[model samples]
Target: MLGPAERAWCVVVPHQPRGARMARHRLSTELVGTIRPGLLADVVAVLAELVGNSVRHAAPLPGEVIRVAWRHRLDGDHDIVQVRVTDGGGGAVPRLRPTDLDSLDGRGLHIVAALATRWGSDRDGLGQSVWAEFRAPAARLPGPDGDDPAPNDLLATR
Candidate 1:
């Protein structure tokens, strides 16, 4: 859910495969800065794939924008991070059907499907946002002797 004033943030993505310097930005950093590196990588991979799909498929109109946003929630004891990538193209339907192995395209959504715990789309006849959610890793406990361990060492054993 985004307010009208905040919608400008959605205009940064390039609608078509070709463009003149399409821009991109991340609207959420709360979990981005807090999640484990490995888990964060997963989130980023999906986000990139979704954004790339928008740029490749969504035909951009003149002076249009593509925006991205994210929100976090708790699913049972696990953390759920939801990411959305939106563009100004018409609500073009996207499918994840199988393609030739030699084709380089059509794999983006497939990757999202395999990685996201859940995913969907939201359309307003103008454009849509492809959203995906991932379960966060278990919370790390403080180290012995009342010290905070390095992020890289949180699950590593010496």
Candidate 2:
């Protein structure tokens, strides 16, 4: 179990067709509950780009699956939300190119870096997971306790 200081939440999207569909289906539903409206918008946008990148670049073969996961955390005083999109693709680390300004296709990563607090990638036996983190609003509160009398109660806001 994670300490209260750790604000991150981890979600796993398996590497299968059903997993991919499930991932998409859960995006709005899950995030709507976990994230604030404004911050949620940013997170979802970044997620779309990263997930699309995985679909286009990752996936081991013609019909392989991609895995995606995300977690929210607090690093120091900053509240952070991190997302990881994993796929079987083993391409080079994505980069932002000057020419990307003129092209419509390659700006995804650039937009991610601009909007996210930090972003990177990792490759292990499980394949690759590209990650991005964004700072939530300072006024935002931590999530509710499971046993709260009022289900709408948020820890930090209290």
Candidate 3:
């Protein structure tokens, strides 16, 4: 289960060509050094796909904007990152499309699926939201010399 640090970041950006870039930059800034580097990259990539799809296919929300939200928390021994993008309802439901070599597009959700531990979409009264969740490896802290070392007792000539 998610721990107490449930506060999430939600940003509203112009639902236009640049929205995806804005979302990626903001999310990367917010999450840097907090999660694993590979996990951070995956999160940013998923955010880009979600925001890009919204801009390309969906309508803007009530004020010509879309909502992007993300949160990360330590759950037990590992970290979990959740990202969501909400847009005015219009486009067809998102799914992993089968793509071949000649396909120029339709691989966004596939990437999301492959990277995220789990993902899905939902609709509310105002709009639709697509979300993905990633489980990061257990946090690793440095030892006294700033490097992880085998426990002293285990290293004692057993």
- Which structure among the candidates has the greatest TM-score? 3
Residues 1-158 of candidate 2 have per-residue lDDT tens digits of 86554444445554444554566566666556445677777777788778777766666432455555666655554446777887775568766666444676878888899888899888777777788888864324444453432222333342
Query: What is candidate 1's lDDT per residue for 31-127, written digit by digit as tens?
Result: 4445556666677778777777777667543465566666554344455667787776545576687878899777888888888998888876656
Per-candidate Cα lDDT values, in order, are 0.61, 0.64, 0.81
lDDT of 2 at 76: 51
Q: Which parts of model 1 have CA positions greater than 4 angstroms off?
A: 1-33, 141-158
TM-score of each: 0.67, 0.70, 0.84
Pairs in clash, predicted candidate 3: none
lDDT: worst 10-residue window of model 3: 149-158
**Clash totals for all candidate models:** 5, 7, 0
Q: Give candidate 2's error at residue 152 in angstroms.
A: 14
Residue 35 in model 2: lDDT: 50
Residues 1-158, model 3: lDDT tens digits:
43354437899988987998999999988877566688889999999999999988899998999999998766655677899999996668888889998999988899999999999999998699999999866445454567753322111212
